[model samples]
Target: MKRIVPLFFWLFAGSVAAQSPNKSSWAPSDNSTIVRIHRVEQVKLEMPFPDGSSFKNLKLDEVMAAYHIPGLSIAIISNYKIIFSKGYGVVTPGSSRPVTPTTLFQAASVSKPITAMASMALVDKHVLMLDEDVNHFLTTWKVPSNTFTEQHPVTLRELISHRAGVNVHGFAGYNRNQSLPTLIQILDGVKPANNPPIRVTAVPGEQESYSGGGIVIEQLLLTDVTHKPFSAIMDDLVLHKLGMINSTFTQPLASQWRSKAASGTNSNGKAVPNQWFVYPEQGPAGLWTTATDLARFAIGLARACNGTPRAILSQPLAKAMVTPFNDGGAQCFHLDPINKGLFSHNGQNEGFESLLVMNWKTGNGLVLLANSDNGEYLWDILLQGVSKEFGWNYHFDQKPKEWLLMAQIVGVDAMLKYFNTQKATGLSENEAGEGDLNQMGYFYLSDGEVSKALSIFKDMVQLYPTSANAYDSLGEAYMAAGEMGAAKESYSKSLALNPQNDNAREKILQLERK
Candidate 1:
């Protein structure tokens, strides 16, 4: 086991004060407007924190200054009532249009839950199976081949929940008329989704890994099972019924909605358009909807969690969707809960930033959608507000918990999107056994303890025997310790598992020449 890093927690209360150049330092006061809304009546509905505040008005404003986001929208609900729904700033950077309830925004991967709901609706009609193998209904590509010794089956649940292990974990190309490739092409990844054929490099269900590509397989599989295009199925189950009149699946950019939609920022802080809006992996994250529609969905989630799946699905399926099957990168509804098992997901693709969370027990929830990159402040502060409404407390010391728990903790960019269309809550729920061994290894490696890191890597390898990185890292650790034989053995194991592993190949060639 890797060394346990010490984490600090406070007794109660946490806050982030805004930093305004014009205003002198302001402290929490009796008359502070930073009060949270526990359950305000007559308001429209939103909040990310879902409870109280630390006087973060200044922090939120500073975020607007930092990211150059021109607009933001939010929705919140408690006990089936709309508490607050509103937008911030201008719709476009320079345009005069003010954001409103009707101002539509592209939700990106925030659209996953909607897709999940639509699929579950079909399941309600006996047209689909939640646990069926996607390969059974496919007319085109299927999950790639791997020499997995374990009999882990890839089911529909794996695709949506992100455990399908299909390695193409992301999308950046969704052009209109992009010559949609066959499902096989998308899976093989010979070209971008619909461009050429997508080749699969790993077997499905080998481990809990993210793959937007896996989602495509599930999407096409859904259509194949229903004998209808994915969009047609969505229109029937959700879009048409929820009155999501302003939403779409495939691209045309809806030039009218462009200005109202949020834009992404470069590392140096500049706006950029979404590259994937123009790829065929639209089902994974191509749908466009507003905070209102999403809030309606969130409310619907609350209803479903409370045994009200709009009569389209069972509460069991809805609960399964929110339950973490393989830690959806904490991207689309993963959990650590800090203690309890909770459901939450954050979607921040190229040009969009969004988040939604719900208490599995209380049925309270919130969704925040920003038209720019001001997600950090907008989301955290809003959640603080949400805490007030829910009478929950914010653990400030636990700030940045999700990132702290992942392999990549800096900026969130990875093609490896986690899927868990599975109904399982997790490997086992509790803050304990639910962390990334790779991440733990990195922390140990960073601390310069090679032996310690190797121990963690060994555990990880045993857990995910098919992962080349686990063996590769173990080999590196052996090499560092001057154990040439052990290093060669580990390297051989890695190469045997993944012949394409350049690092292992290079290490082996060096040993042979020596």
Candidate 2:
């Protein structure tokens, strides 16, 4: 991985580690496109789908009401500084408690990136070794020796990268009245912990797999090594250093902070019994933070990547943290390739949802928190709006729904003819990509529009004749359309193209038996 040089070292660079930007000064600048767009409540932006329709101006208030989100908080960072921070709606469904800029929400899996950052700090201080076998450092309950471990002992690096083959993709938090399990009990999947035991399911360093269970191991390692609580260690190592004063990894947040905490709500806007789900799995899904605080953490990381003096991680370690460990998986942060040097992660625990993104190169980022399970429905709109307002190079795409509208307007046959002609003329801007078209076909199938789906899959197979997946999808579409002979033919072609296509092989067997 390449080291990120400080931003000020470049030709156009002016200064480094200067004072944070003034938000009031950013108001409606007449000369700036970003300023003009920022003034609007919502801005229309293009989605990823080539054939998808662009959404018109969407209002935040309308979206919140439509989605039943009780509250939302947002912060935008520009040029290694916070440019804007605001809150919307209420802390609870029927409460008069308006969510303020300081109100905290559950950070959920966003906690993983923070945990990884703290671990990197440990690496810098020689307190933790990334490539060292984690079992050697763990003083608490040990990971059981299994067949997988005999071949390859799991390392801290692999654990953070999610290539350790750890089981348990995520955790669903316990209800307010439910008995909370100890960290060991959670790892062992005994009693109160709802999920199965965290164990290696494949050879370490095999492939990319998301595992919250792996992060929990890091949490344990941090506590055991430091002889202090995870929250306290993080505070000293990363949180306090980054000036994220409104954030903490403490599970079951203390009573004094309750008034500033946003209550979680379901899709229908009903509040959770205890206002929020309790996440004892601290490394993966336990952090209470405001968007402003998270933005501070992001800015600190950007400054660190740029080699600013007094920054948290050194340039080498920061680069490695964002570097993809196995395949395309970043150690903890999720990589967004659309924009250059982007690292992001999203989180969901019960009714609360959160996302944090930062473009390290540009020192631009955004943080969003919503107190509703259905908040995801508004993510695209909200992100695109912010991107447009700030002129950030973020890509937000949707599955092509223009095909459905086109089928309604020019008829499916006409659309098919147009798509089929792409063989010689080449794919146009409006033509669907393999994944997008495949998903669109499946959406139609799920919606019981069998004829429309068959048309789509037929086009897909025609366009991508050698694709095993395309044929498999076509076969599924055929089966749904009740054309068993056609389905069998498609499946056979799929199996021939890729013998490892278990889905096609199974479908063929079922058809043969019938």
Candidate 3:
């Protein structure tokens, strides 16, 4: 069974690391056109998440079971209310704590929006000027030196928006228990500083730089401006006002909170719990929350967006805060189109993944947090349930089964087990005899499973005796497999199915020459 599926090869490839060899046939769904028309219509409703229904098909319990997530939390915000917030599974899998709505999970990057809210509040109070150089209030940290470009002092807006133009990038180092360095030391590549972290290395305001250190620099300004630690500021400003009693800025496991720490599995597939409080990088990353509390935050933003009553960040600034910026990554969660936009953010540590989605219009939003690395699978499923229920545009194509089947084939070593066990490579002479086998053949073909593509095409020809496209794709698959003779015959058969087949005719001539 020479399966010819080229696996995705990338080092620390960002989420959606889809470079798989068997992942060539994704004709982005008809959803793209629908998305444009909706944008044109700009449907205004009290709530649009699941349209006429609630996103409740795959319950939290089911998703947790599938992903091995000890705990999971989700909140959907619309109409300025706690419209949907729930928790499922276990806090520790073996422990007795059934995850509750208030269970505190390590709110990874979700912390940034909290920080953004705090900063925007400061902006409203005139204590934090968005356009002013952050250096004015900051005395403890200074930008690192680099010859790549001149350092134009970064502003408060640039830091929060991830537009500082220098990505200090990932921090596989710096965890709990070790004496953490000052934010300045982290940026300067000083002692105990595990990774060099990304040096300012680029001119400020030139591009987006996703630096946790940049957020730390912003945190330091909290002290410089307010004469208090970030923890206190969060307690006084965000927690108290929002009434997020179960959530805090400290480590998830240590707080007097519940045992629902967000978690993820390591390379060995062992579940690892996550909550880092070694250093408080408020602007970039550092904050813990529960789905319930997070839903409140999302609700507040949505209310503020729709001119509904709320107090998170005032309508305009909260509107501005959701605006997108470069994060040393691709364009995603874009809230403000070419003009004003909103953004999406994710948090990931050893055992957990967290996502927060905010929309600039109608102020609708949603967040899903998981206690396992595969928690994203739950997110995908929930998004589907939401889309099917509400008809709202969350932008996830409903082809998850197809995508996951492909992902499983590409991501796992079980390919030979499943692919090699199939029956005859072509149709069984009976009409209803081989339905499941044919579906599997089609699955393999759509996913770039080269040998399977060939087999499926052969089956289609035998079963239908009149599928031009099927035969054409079969020819292309053989051509890809370096079998010119087989490809030529397949192409010729496809052209015979329809005399107007220019593409198949051309391919047939090309194969003949070959």
Write candidate 3's Cα lDDT for 351-458 as tens digits: 566776655554555676666545554454454444445445555422332222322323222322232232235423331223333444444444457676566556
Looking at model 2, residue 191 earns an lDDT score of 90
Report lDDT (Cα) of residue 439, candidate 1: 51
Candidate 2: residue 360 Cα off by (Å):
0.8
Steric overlap count per candidate: 57, 1, 17
The full ranking of all candidates by TM-score, starting with the best, is 2, 3, 1
lDDT-superior candidate, 1 or 3? 1
- Flag regions of model 2 displaced more than 4 Å: 1-40, 43-56, 394-514
lDDT of 1 at 102: 57
Candidates ranked by lDDT, best first?
2, 1, 3
| Alpha-carbon lDDT of model 2 | 0.74
Which regions in candidate 3 have their CA more than 4 angstroms from the true location?
1-63, 145-151, 173-177, 251-255, 258-264, 267-269, 273-283, 307-310, 324-343, 393-398, 401-514
Per-model TM against the reference: 0.62, 0.72, 0.63
What global local distance difference test value does model 1 have?
0.55
TM-score, candidate 1, is: 0.62
Give the Å error, residue 413, model 3.
Answer: 7.9
Q: Provide the lowest-lDDT 10-residue window in model 1.
A: 7-16
Give the candidate number with the greatest TM-score.
2
| CA lDDT for candidate 3 | 0.55
Q: lDDT per residue, candidate 1, 245-341, as tens digits?
A: 7676645465676654544442223344432244356577767776667766766665676686354457877767666545334324655456243
lDDT score, residue 359, model 2?
Answer: 86
